[model samples]
Target: MTTEFSPRLFERDSEIRALGEGLLACALPREAWTHEAHLGACLWLLSERPDIDVDAEIGGIIRRFNESVGGVNDDTQGYHDSITRAYVAGVRLFLSETTATSLVERVNAMLLSDVGRRDWPLRFYSRELLFSVPARRGFVEPDRMPLPVAHK
Candidate 1:
Protein backbone atom coordinates (compact mmCIF):
# COMPACT_ATOMS: atom_id res chain seq x y z
CA MET A 1 0.00 0.00 0.00
CA THR A 2 1.27 3.50 -0.90
CA THR A 3 0.89 6.36 1.56
CA GLU A 4 -0.58 9.51 0.14
CA PHE A 5 -0.15 12.89 1.76
CA SER A 6 -3.20 15.15 1.89
CA PRO A 7 -2.36 18.81 1.41
CA ARG A 8 -5.79 19.77 2.68
CA LEU A 9 -4.64 19.15 6.22
CA PHE A 10 -1.81 21.64 5.91
CA GLU A 11 -4.03 24.14 4.16
CA ARG A 12 -6.65 23.99 6.88
CA ASP A 13 -4.07 24.39 9.59
CA SER A 14 -2.58 27.39 7.81
CA GLU A 15 -5.98 28.96 7.45
CA ILE A 16 -6.70 28.41 11.14
CA ARG A 17 -3.37 29.93 12.14
CA ALA A 18 -3.94 32.94 9.92
CA LEU A 19 -7.30 33.51 11.52
CA GLY A 20 -5.71 33.17 14.95
CA GLU A 21 -3.09 35.76 14.06
CA GLY A 22 -5.75 38.13 12.85
CA LEU A 23 -7.58 37.80 16.16
CA LEU A 24 -4.36 38.46 18.05
CA ALA A 25 -3.65 41.53 15.99
CA CYS A 26 -7.07 42.93 16.74
CA ALA A 27 -6.41 42.73 20.46
CA LEU A 28 -5.54 46.42 20.72
CA PRO A 29 -6.90 49.57 22.31
CA ARG A 30 -9.92 50.86 20.41
CA GLU A 31 -12.58 53.46 20.16
CA ALA A 32 -16.36 53.04 19.89
CA TRP A 33 -16.42 52.84 16.11
CA THR A 34 -13.81 50.11 16.08
CA HIS A 35 -16.11 47.79 18.02
CA GLU A 36 -18.21 46.91 15.00
CA ALA A 37 -15.11 46.55 12.87
CA HIS A 38 -13.48 44.22 15.40
CA LEU A 39 -16.61 42.11 15.62
CA GLY A 40 -16.82 42.04 11.85
CA ALA A 41 -13.37 40.50 11.64
CA CYS A 42 -14.39 38.08 14.37
CA LEU A 43 -17.44 37.01 12.41
CA TRP A 44 -15.29 36.37 9.39
CA LEU A 45 -12.97 34.13 11.37
CA LEU A 46 -15.87 32.36 13.08
CA SER A 47 -17.50 31.72 9.71
CA GLU A 48 -14.38 29.81 8.70
CA ARG A 49 -14.55 27.69 11.87
CA PRO A 50 -17.78 25.76 11.58
CA ASP A 51 -16.95 23.59 14.55
CA ILE A 52 -17.30 26.56 16.88
CA ASP A 53 -20.81 27.66 17.84
CA VAL A 54 -20.68 31.35 16.95
CA ASP A 55 -24.19 32.20 18.01
CA ALA A 56 -23.90 30.60 21.42
CA GLU A 57 -20.57 32.27 22.13
CA ILE A 58 -21.82 35.67 21.06
CA GLY A 59 -24.97 35.25 23.13
CA GLY A 60 -22.99 34.26 26.18
CA ILE A 61 -20.66 37.26 25.81
CA ILE A 62 -23.60 39.62 25.54
CA ARG A 63 -25.42 38.04 28.44
CA ARG A 64 -22.40 38.08 30.69
CA PHE A 65 -21.60 41.67 29.76
CA ASN A 66 -25.15 42.74 30.49
CA GLU A 67 -25.27 40.86 33.77
CA SER A 68 -21.96 42.30 34.83
CA VAL A 69 -23.04 45.88 34.28
CA GLY A 70 -26.73 45.43 35.15
CA GLY A 71 -27.75 48.52 33.14
CA VAL A 72 -26.31 51.08 30.75
CA ASN A 73 -26.08 53.94 33.21
CA ASP A 74 -22.39 54.77 33.49
CA ASP A 75 -19.48 54.86 31.10
CA THR A 76 -18.67 51.20 31.72
CA GLN A 77 -22.24 50.19 31.03
CA GLY A 78 -22.22 52.36 27.94
CA TYR A 79 -19.15 50.57 26.71
CA HIS A 80 -20.95 47.27 27.05
CA ASP A 81 -23.85 48.71 25.14
CA SER A 82 -21.50 49.59 22.29
CA ILE A 83 -20.13 46.06 22.36
CA THR A 84 -23.67 44.76 21.99
CA ARG A 85 -24.12 46.94 18.96
CA ALA A 86 -20.85 45.67 17.51
CA TYR A 87 -21.93 42.10 18.07
CA VAL A 88 -25.16 42.77 16.21
CA ALA A 89 -23.24 44.35 13.36
CA GLY A 90 -20.93 41.34 13.26
CA VAL A 91 -23.83 38.95 12.91
CA ARG A 92 -25.28 41.09 10.18
CA LEU A 93 -22.00 41.18 8.31
CA PHE A 94 -21.55 37.45 8.71
CA LEU A 95 -24.93 36.78 7.10
CA SER A 96 -24.64 39.42 4.41
CA GLU A 97 -22.68 39.29 1.16
CA THR A 98 -19.94 41.62 2.36
CA THR A 99 -16.32 40.52 1.99
CA ALA A 100 -14.37 39.67 5.10
CA THR A 101 -10.98 40.49 3.64
CA SER A 102 -11.76 44.16 3.22
CA LEU A 103 -13.32 44.44 6.64
CA VAL A 104 -10.34 42.71 8.25
CA GLU A 105 -7.98 45.16 6.62
CA ARG A 106 -10.03 48.11 7.80
CA VAL A 107 -10.06 46.72 11.33
CA ASN A 108 -6.33 46.22 11.28
CA ALA A 109 -5.71 49.77 10.20
CA MET A 110 -8.03 51.22 12.79
CA LEU A 111 -6.53 49.14 15.59
CA LEU A 112 -2.96 49.95 14.62
CA SER A 113 -3.80 53.65 14.51
CA ASP A 114 -5.09 53.41 18.06
CA VAL A 115 -8.10 55.52 17.24
CA GLY A 116 -9.80 54.66 20.51
CA ARG A 117 -7.49 53.47 23.22
CA ARG A 118 -9.64 54.66 26.09
CA ASP A 119 -12.04 51.76 25.69
CA TRP A 120 -9.46 49.02 26.11
CA PRO A 121 -11.79 46.70 27.99
CA LEU A 122 -14.38 46.50 25.24
CA ARG A 123 -11.63 46.05 22.65
CA PHE A 124 -10.07 43.31 24.74
CA TYR A 125 -13.32 41.39 25.01
CA SER A 126 -14.03 41.79 21.33
CA ARG A 127 -10.66 40.25 20.54
CA GLU A 128 -11.25 37.57 23.15
CA LEU A 129 -14.49 36.61 21.45
CA LEU A 130 -12.65 36.43 18.15
CA PHE A 131 -9.87 34.33 19.68
CA SER A 132 -12.42 31.89 21.06
CA VAL A 133 -13.19 30.60 17.58
CA PRO A 134 -9.66 29.32 17.03
CA ALA A 135 -9.29 28.31 20.63
CA ARG A 136 -12.37 26.14 20.34
CA ARG A 137 -11.03 24.75 17.09
CA GLY A 138 -7.79 23.78 18.89
CA PHE A 139 -5.57 26.23 17.02
CA VAL A 140 -4.49 28.37 19.96
CA GLU A 141 -0.92 28.11 21.20
CA PRO A 142 -0.16 29.89 24.48
CA ASP A 143 3.40 30.55 23.41
CA ARG A 144 2.36 32.06 20.13
CA MET A 145 0.65 35.05 21.74
CA PRO A 146 -0.29 35.98 25.25
CA LEU A 147 -3.97 35.80 26.08
CA PRO A 148 -5.87 39.04 26.56
CA VAL A 149 -5.45 40.47 30.01
CA ALA A 150 -8.58 39.99 32.11
CA HIS A 151 -10.57 43.18 32.58
CA LYS A 152 -11.59 43.74 36.15
Candidate 2:
Protein backbone atom coordinates (compact mmCIF):
# COMPACT_ATOMS: atom_id res chain seq x y z
CA MET A 1 0.00 0.00 0.00
CA THR A 2 2.56 2.53 1.11
CA THR A 3 5.72 1.80 -0.78
CA GLU A 4 6.67 -1.82 -0.44
CA PHE A 5 6.13 -2.98 3.12
CA SER A 6 8.47 -5.95 3.01
CA PRO A 7 11.13 -6.43 0.38
CA ARG A 8 10.76 -10.18 0.84
CA LEU A 9 7.04 -10.03 0.14
CA PHE A 10 6.09 -7.14 -2.12
CA GLU A 11 8.54 -5.53 -4.52
CA ARG A 12 6.25 -3.10 -6.30
CA ASP A 13 3.00 -1.21 -6.01
CA SER A 14 1.46 -3.29 -8.76
CA GLU A 15 2.04 -6.42 -6.73
CA ILE A 16 0.09 -4.93 -3.88
CA ARG A 17 -2.57 -3.81 -6.33
CA ALA A 18 -2.79 -7.32 -7.66
CA LEU A 19 -3.22 -8.62 -4.16
CA GLY A 20 -6.12 -6.22 -3.65
CA GLU A 21 -7.63 -7.12 -6.99
CA GLY A 22 -7.45 -10.84 -6.30
CA LEU A 23 -8.86 -10.34 -2.85
CA LEU A 24 -11.72 -8.19 -4.09
CA ALA A 25 -12.55 -10.76 -6.73
CA CYS A 26 -12.30 -13.68 -4.31
CA ALA A 27 -9.74 -15.21 -6.57
CA LEU A 28 -6.81 -15.47 -4.20
CA PRO A 29 -5.97 -18.92 -2.96
CA ARG A 30 -6.45 -19.53 0.75
CA GLU A 31 -2.78 -20.26 1.19
CA ALA A 32 -1.91 -16.93 -0.39
CA TRP A 33 -3.98 -15.10 2.15
CA THR A 34 -1.12 -14.56 4.53
CA HIS A 35 -0.99 -11.89 7.26
CA GLU A 36 1.25 -9.75 5.07
CA ALA A 37 -1.22 -10.09 2.23
CA HIS A 38 -4.03 -8.94 4.46
CA LEU A 39 -2.10 -5.84 5.37
CA GLY A 40 -1.02 -5.37 1.79
CA ALA A 41 -4.54 -5.48 0.45
CA CYS A 42 -5.80 -3.14 3.12
CA LEU A 43 -2.97 -0.74 2.48
CA TRP A 44 -3.79 -0.77 -1.22
CA LEU A 45 -7.39 -0.04 -0.42
CA LEU A 46 -6.54 2.70 2.01
CA SER A 47 -3.85 4.45 0.02
CA GLU A 48 -4.80 4.00 -3.61
CA ARG A 49 -8.49 3.18 -3.74
CA PRO A 50 -9.92 6.36 -2.37
CA ASP A 51 -13.19 5.48 -4.03
CA ILE A 52 -13.59 2.75 -1.47
CA ASP A 53 -15.17 3.58 1.84
CA VAL A 54 -12.79 1.32 3.72
CA ASP A 55 -14.34 1.77 7.16
CA ALA A 56 -17.74 0.80 5.80
CA GLU A 57 -16.69 -1.69 3.17
CA ILE A 58 -13.94 -3.62 4.92
CA GLY A 59 -16.19 -6.04 6.81
CA GLY A 60 -18.19 -7.07 3.80
CA ILE A 61 -15.04 -7.41 1.76
CA ILE A 62 -13.53 -9.72 4.36
CA ARG A 63 -16.70 -11.77 4.73
CA ARG A 64 -16.93 -12.31 0.99
CA PHE A 65 -13.31 -13.33 0.71
CA ASN A 66 -13.60 -15.66 3.66
CA GLU A 67 -16.65 -17.39 2.23
CA SER A 68 -14.99 -17.73 -1.15
CA VAL A 69 -12.09 -19.50 0.53
CA GLY A 70 -14.43 -21.87 2.40
CA GLY A 71 -13.66 -20.17 5.64
CA VAL A 72 -16.56 -19.76 8.05
CA ASN A 73 -17.27 -16.44 9.68
CA ASP A 74 -18.75 -17.86 12.82
CA ASP A 75 -18.22 -17.21 16.51
CA THR A 76 -14.83 -18.89 16.58
CA GLN A 77 -13.26 -18.22 13.19
CA GLY A 78 -12.84 -15.84 10.25
CA TYR A 79 -13.55 -12.17 9.48
CA HIS A 80 -12.28 -10.44 12.57
CA ASP A 81 -13.93 -7.00 12.56
CA SER A 82 -12.17 -5.42 15.50
CA ILE A 83 -8.75 -6.40 14.34
CA THR A 84 -9.50 -5.26 10.82
CA ARG A 85 -10.79 -1.85 11.82
CA ALA A 86 -8.00 -1.36 14.32
CA TYR A 87 -5.48 -1.96 11.60
CA VAL A 88 -7.28 0.49 9.36
CA ALA A 89 -7.00 3.04 12.08
CA GLY A 90 -3.39 2.21 12.61
CA VAL A 91 -2.62 2.35 8.91
CA ARG A 92 -4.34 5.69 8.61
CA LEU A 93 -2.27 7.08 11.41
CA PHE A 94 0.88 5.78 9.88
CA LEU A 95 0.08 7.11 6.44
CA SER A 96 -0.99 10.51 7.67
CA GLU A 97 2.58 11.37 8.56
CA THR A 98 4.42 9.11 6.17
CA THR A 99 7.44 10.27 4.18
CA ALA A 100 7.56 7.62 1.48
CA THR A 101 6.47 8.61 -2.04
CA SER A 102 5.77 5.19 -3.46
CA LEU A 103 3.21 2.68 -2.30
CA VAL A 104 5.65 -0.21 -2.11
CA GLU A 105 8.19 1.77 -0.10
CA ARG A 106 5.57 2.85 2.40
CA VAL A 107 4.26 -0.66 2.86
CA ASN A 108 7.75 -1.98 3.49
CA ALA A 109 8.46 0.78 5.99
CA MET A 110 5.17 0.12 7.71
CA LEU A 111 6.02 -3.55 7.95
CA LEU A 112 9.23 -2.51 9.58
CA SER A 113 7.28 -0.38 12.06
CA ASP A 114 5.55 -1.57 15.20
CA VAL A 115 2.17 -1.60 13.48
CA GLY A 116 3.46 -4.32 11.18
CA ARG A 117 3.71 -6.81 13.98
CA ARG A 118 0.99 -9.46 14.26
CA ASP A 119 0.48 -8.40 17.85
CA TRP A 120 0.32 -4.65 17.16
CA PRO A 121 -3.25 -4.34 18.37
CA LEU A 122 -2.41 -5.95 21.69
CA ARG A 123 -0.79 -2.71 22.67
CA PHE A 124 -4.25 -1.17 22.76
CA TYR A 125 -6.55 -4.09 23.44
CA SER A 126 -6.38 -6.73 26.10
CA ARG A 127 -5.83 -10.22 24.69
CA GLU A 128 -9.09 -11.39 26.24
CA LEU A 129 -11.06 -8.53 24.72
CA LEU A 130 -9.37 -8.49 21.32
CA PHE A 131 -9.85 -12.17 20.64
CA SER A 132 -13.41 -12.36 21.95
CA VAL A 133 -16.37 -13.45 19.83
CA PRO A 134 -17.80 -9.94 19.96
CA ALA A 135 -14.53 -8.55 18.73
CA ARG A 136 -14.39 -11.03 15.92
CA ARG A 137 -17.93 -10.11 14.90
CA GLY A 138 -17.83 -6.32 15.30
CA PHE A 139 -15.74 -3.32 16.21
CA VAL A 140 -14.90 -3.15 19.91
CA GLU A 141 -13.26 -0.26 21.69
CA PRO A 142 -9.81 -0.91 23.01
CA ASP A 143 -9.84 -1.64 26.73
CA ARG A 144 -6.19 -0.79 27.24
CA MET A 145 -5.71 2.34 25.11
CA PRO A 146 -7.73 4.56 22.86
CA LEU A 147 -6.87 4.34 19.19
CA PRO A 148 -4.99 7.38 17.92
CA VAL A 149 -7.67 7.93 15.30
CA ALA A 150 -10.36 7.64 17.96
CA HIS A 151 -8.73 10.36 19.98
CA LYS A 152 -10.10 12.86 17.50
Candidate 3:
Protein backbone atom coordinates (compact mmCIF):
# COMPACT_ATOMS: atom_id res chain seq x y z
CA MET A 1 0.00 0.00 0.00
CA THR A 2 2.92 2.36 -0.36
CA THR A 3 2.34 5.09 -2.98
CA GLU A 4 4.83 6.14 -5.61
CA PHE A 5 5.08 9.76 -6.70
CA SER A 6 6.79 11.12 -9.76
CA PRO A 7 7.27 14.69 -10.91
CA ARG A 8 6.37 13.61 -14.40
CA LEU A 9 3.06 12.42 -13.06
CA PHE A 10 2.31 15.86 -11.64
CA GLU A 11 3.43 17.56 -14.86
CA ARG A 12 0.47 16.07 -16.66
CA ASP A 13 -2.01 17.57 -14.21
CA SER A 14 -3.58 19.78 -16.83
CA GLU A 15 -4.14 16.86 -19.15
CA ILE A 16 -5.64 14.78 -16.35
CA ARG A 17 -7.90 17.66 -15.32
CA ALA A 18 -9.07 18.18 -18.89
CA LEU A 19 -9.84 14.50 -19.25
CA GLY A 20 -11.69 14.43 -15.95
CA GLU A 21 -13.65 17.49 -17.07
CA GLY A 22 -14.51 15.76 -20.31
CA LEU A 23 -15.81 12.79 -18.36
CA LEU A 24 -17.88 15.10 -16.21
CA ALA A 25 -19.25 16.80 -19.30
CA CYS A 26 -20.42 13.46 -20.64
CA ALA A 27 -21.70 12.39 -17.23
CA LEU A 28 -25.32 12.42 -18.33
CA PRO A 29 -24.82 9.81 -20.96
CA ARG A 30 -22.22 7.09 -20.62
CA GLU A 31 -18.91 8.30 -21.98
CA ALA A 32 -16.76 6.41 -24.39
CA TRP A 33 -13.26 5.62 -23.20
CA THR A 34 -10.70 7.88 -24.82
CA HIS A 35 -6.92 7.70 -24.82
CA GLU A 36 -6.64 10.81 -22.66
CA ALA A 37 -9.12 9.59 -20.11
CA HIS A 38 -7.60 6.15 -19.95
CA LEU A 39 -4.19 7.68 -19.52
CA GLY A 40 -5.49 9.85 -16.74
CA ALA A 41 -7.07 6.89 -15.06
CA CYS A 42 -3.93 4.80 -15.32
CA LEU A 43 -1.85 7.67 -14.07
CA TRP A 44 -4.07 7.96 -11.05
CA LEU A 45 -3.81 4.26 -10.43
CA LEU A 46 -0.05 4.19 -10.79
CA SER A 47 0.46 7.07 -8.40
CA GLU A 48 -1.90 5.56 -5.91
CA ARG A 49 -0.67 2.00 -6.16
CA PRO A 50 2.47 1.38 -8.12
CA ASP A 51 2.58 -2.21 -7.00
CA ILE A 52 -0.46 -3.07 -9.08
CA ASP A 53 0.01 -5.83 -11.62
CA VAL A 54 -0.77 -3.79 -14.71
CA ASP A 55 -0.46 -6.71 -17.07
CA ALA A 56 -2.80 -8.92 -15.11
CA GLU A 57 -5.29 -6.10 -14.62
CA ILE A 58 -5.37 -5.06 -18.26
CA GLY A 59 -5.53 -8.69 -19.31
CA GLY A 60 -8.61 -9.03 -17.19
CA ILE A 61 -10.00 -5.98 -18.97
CA ILE A 62 -9.46 -7.75 -22.27
CA ARG A 63 -11.28 -10.78 -20.94
CA ARG A 64 -14.15 -8.63 -19.75
CA PHE A 65 -14.30 -7.05 -23.19
CA ASN A 66 -14.48 -10.45 -24.79
CA GLU A 67 -17.28 -11.61 -22.51
CA SER A 68 -19.22 -8.42 -23.04
CA VAL A 69 -18.73 -7.98 -26.78
CA GLY A 70 -18.47 -11.55 -28.09
CA GLY A 71 -16.15 -11.78 -31.13
CA VAL A 72 -14.10 -9.08 -32.78
CA ASN A 73 -14.82 -8.27 -36.40
CA ASP A 74 -14.03 -5.51 -38.89
CA ASP A 75 -16.10 -3.04 -36.91
CA THR A 76 -14.57 -3.87 -33.52
CA GLN A 77 -10.96 -4.57 -34.37
CA GLY A 78 -10.30 -0.87 -34.69
CA TYR A 79 -11.45 -0.32 -31.13
CA HIS A 80 -9.10 -3.03 -29.86
CA ASP A 81 -6.22 -1.52 -31.77
CA SER A 82 -7.05 1.91 -30.41
CA ILE A 83 -7.17 0.63 -26.84
CA THR A 84 -3.71 -0.92 -27.16
CA ARG A 85 -2.31 2.26 -28.65
CA ALA A 86 -3.99 4.35 -25.99
CA TYR A 87 -2.63 2.16 -23.20
CA VAL A 88 0.89 2.63 -24.47
CA ALA A 89 0.46 6.32 -25.12
CA GLY A 90 -0.97 6.87 -21.67
CA VAL A 91 2.05 5.26 -20.02
CA ARG A 92 4.46 7.23 -22.14
CA LEU A 93 2.76 10.56 -21.60
CA PHE A 94 2.24 10.45 -17.86
CA LEU A 95 5.18 8.54 -16.46
CA SER A 96 8.91 9.22 -16.30
CA GLU A 97 10.85 8.23 -19.36
CA THR A 98 12.42 5.18 -17.76
CA THR A 99 9.22 4.04 -16.10
CA ALA A 100 7.15 4.84 -19.15
CA THR A 101 9.47 2.97 -21.45
CA SER A 102 9.47 -0.10 -19.27
CA LEU A 103 5.69 -0.03 -18.93
CA VAL A 104 5.12 0.52 -22.63
CA GLU A 105 7.43 -2.39 -23.36
CA ARG A 106 5.60 -4.65 -20.94
CA VAL A 107 2.23 -3.58 -22.29
CA ASN A 108 3.39 -4.04 -25.86
CA ALA A 109 4.57 -7.48 -24.98
CA MET A 110 1.24 -8.23 -23.37
CA LEU A 111 -0.61 -7.03 -26.46
CA LEU A 112 1.52 -9.38 -28.50
CA SER A 113 0.85 -12.15 -26.04
CA ASP A 114 -2.30 -14.22 -26.44
CA VAL A 115 -4.10 -12.92 -23.37
CA GLY A 116 -3.97 -9.29 -24.47
CA ARG A 117 -5.86 -10.03 -27.68
CA ARG A 118 -9.18 -8.68 -26.38
CA ASP A 119 -10.51 -5.20 -25.82
CA TRP A 120 -13.45 -3.68 -23.94
CA PRO A 121 -17.08 -3.58 -25.10
CA LEU A 122 -17.34 0.12 -24.23
CA ARG A 123 -14.59 2.66 -23.53
CA PHE A 124 -16.43 3.76 -20.43
CA TYR A 125 -14.82 0.96 -18.47
CA SER A 126 -11.84 3.13 -17.71
CA ARG A 127 -14.05 6.07 -16.84
CA GLU A 128 -16.26 3.94 -14.67
CA LEU A 129 -13.24 2.58 -12.84
CA LEU A 130 -11.77 6.04 -12.48
CA PHE A 131 -14.92 7.56 -11.05
CA SER A 132 -16.25 4.68 -9.05
CA VAL A 133 -13.62 2.36 -7.60
CA PRO A 134 -11.44 4.95 -5.90
CA ALA A 135 -14.34 6.64 -4.13
CA ARG A 136 -15.76 3.37 -2.99
CA ARG A 137 -12.39 2.20 -1.72
CA GLY A 138 -11.70 5.48 0.07
CA PHE A 139 -8.77 6.38 -2.14
CA VAL A 140 -8.17 10.07 -2.63
CA GLU A 141 -7.90 11.37 -6.17
CA PRO A 142 -4.27 12.13 -6.92
CA ASP A 143 -3.21 15.77 -7.37
CA ARG A 144 -6.23 16.95 -5.42
CA MET A 145 -5.29 19.05 -2.41
CA PRO A 146 -7.34 20.48 0.40
CA LEU A 147 -8.20 24.14 0.00
CA PRO A 148 -6.41 26.53 2.31
CA VAL A 149 -8.39 28.12 5.10
CA ALA A 150 -9.34 31.74 4.34
CA HIS A 151 -8.03 34.49 6.55
CA LYS A 152 -10.51 37.09 7.77
The CA lDDT at 137 in model 1 is 36
Per-candidate RMSD vs. true structure?
17.7, 4.5, 16.5
lDDT of 3 by residue, 1-152 (tens): 43332212223445454543443333311243443345554544454345655544543443344344443423324224334434544343334433343433433333333223233212323444334433323323323322122122
TM-score of 2: 0.91
lDDT digits (tens) for residues 4-121 of candidate 1: 3221111233433454344444332233223443343454445555765654554444333434434332332322333443343434433453332544443433333323123333
Q: Candidate 1: lDDT over CA atoms? A: 0.39
What tens digits encode model 2's per-residue C-alpha lDDT throughout 57-142? 99999899999999999999989999998899888887887788898988877777877878889889999999999999889999
Q: Rate the local accuracy (lDDT) of all candidates.
A: 0.39, 0.87, 0.38
Q: Which parts of model 1 have CA positions greater than 4 angstroms off?
A: 1-37, 59-86, 89-91, 99-152
Residue 86 CA error for candidate 3 (Å)? 7.1
- lDDT (Cα) of model 3: 0.38
User: Model 2: residues >4 Å from true position, as ranges?
Assistant: 1-8, 150-152
Candidate 3 TM-score, C-alpha based: 0.32
- Against the true structure, whose TM-score is highest? 2
